[model samples]
Target: MKLYGSLTSPYVRKARVLIHEKNMAVEFVNEDPWTEDSPVIGRNPLSKVPVLEIGVDSYMFESPLVVHYLDHVDGKSFTPRDPAGYWQSQWWQSLGQGIIDAGIARVFETRRPLDKQMPEKMQREEQRIHRAIDLAEKTIKENSEFLLGNRYGLADIVMGVAMQYTDFRYPHDWRSRAPKLNQWLKGIAARPSFVDTQPPGFEPPAA
Candidate 1:
């Protein structure tokens, strides 16, 4: 399997981290979705990154679906098999993905020329990010160690990558606001999967 995405993309990072955690053998193909010549458009009509090619004429887009497929193939999915637990995990994943969406929007908005940038849109995205941080703090405080109860599963992986991306792009002092979540991320950051997949020039500084 080949995963096509940029290294700095949080969505792509989520897929890459899951692949490493599952110890799956897959090729990493760096592709910029913004470019017209990108191969991602061929695989996905939406022209999104993190498109997983399983076989000839077989492809999977969307980070969650790609991760789900990988987990299904490995037979050791991080998401709970139980219905209740599955939905709970999916809820957390949605929140994490929400953060990723808002952050990416903010990044792109800021990249635009000052006159062309939309302050209102950027403000809305910032508010969304703050709301996510508050929600994450509450969730982690209530459920110590991981997002879904005590297990480190898909929810935790999704949230962890989202936090890392925010830190890289926004550079906020979120640790003070969400201490538990910060510490939780610190532990996960030590994992080989995370360390190996750290975005280029965005790795956490030495303690």
Candidate 2:
């Protein structure tokens, strides 16, 4: 399998980290769609990174779809199997994706030409990220052993990348606002999946 995407993209990181944790072998092809001549345009009609080639000339887009496919390709399921834990994982999965989406929007909004940038849109994204995280803290604390779906499952993997990327691109003192979330993040740093896939030139805060 060949995974094509930018190394710094959080969406791509989601796939990379999962493949690592599952001990799956994949050839990573760095493809930046922003370049004048890019191959991602062919793999993904939408021209998005993280397009995974699962078979000869066949591919899949959308991080969640790639994640759901890859999470089970290693002869076992990495997601929650029980009824309640299954839904917990699903909930976090949605929240995790939202965090990354808001973070990406906020950062890209700032990259726009200064005059063309919309402050209100940026502020809205910022609030969405903060609120989503706050909700995560409350949800995890309310349910014991549900830090990332009652155990380390697909939801944890996705949310871990989301938070790490948030800290990387969106600078803030979030550790204070969500102390439990901060501590949970620190614990996942030791996982080889995360250490090996750390974004280029960006080091996570010291554990």
Candidate 3:
């Protein structure tokens, strides 16, 4: 199996975490989708990061699908096989990933030259990001440690990737404001796979 994606992408991080958690041995191919040479375009027409190719045949794109498929393939169960537990993880994953999209957009907007930046759009994204963070923090506070039930499950993994993205892109402000989440993120970061796979530096994807 092979995974192709940029290290900085939160979406990529989610797939990477699942691979590690499942102890799956797969080659990690570094590819920048923005570049015309990127093979991601061939596997997925969307040219998105975190595309997973299974063996010589099947393939899956997008972080959510990649992780979900991985959990399914492992058969050991990262997600609950039951309906309620399944839906809970699904909801948290959506909320968690929504923040990632907003964060990505916010960063892109900020990277633009001052004259080209759209203040209104940036403000909207920033608010969305904050609300997402608050919701996550509240969930963590209500649940003791993991997002779902007692053990760390799909929900934790999904939110973990999202929080990691926040640290990689936004850093100080959000981290300081959400101390408990920061602590949780620290624990997640301590995992060998996460430490090994974290995106290096702050380079932006090519236009």
Which digits, one per residue and each the tens of the lDDT, describe model 3 over residues 21-86? 878987899998998777778899999988899867667998888888888886787887789988
Ranking by lDDT: 1, 2, 3
What residue pairs are clashing in model 1?
Answer: none
Using Cα atoms with residue i matched to residue i, what is each candidate's TM-score against the true structure?
A: 0.94, 0.94, 0.88
Candidate 1 per-residue lDDT, tens place, 50-111, comes to 89999998999999898889878867889988899899889889998999999999999999
Root-mean-square deviation of every model: 1.6, 1.7, 4.2
Preferred candidate (TM-score higher): 1 or 3: 1
Q: Which structure is stronger by TM-score: 2 or 3?
A: 2
- Each prediction's Cα lDDT score? 0.87, 0.86, 0.79
Q: What is the lDDT of residue 86 in candidate 2?
A: 80
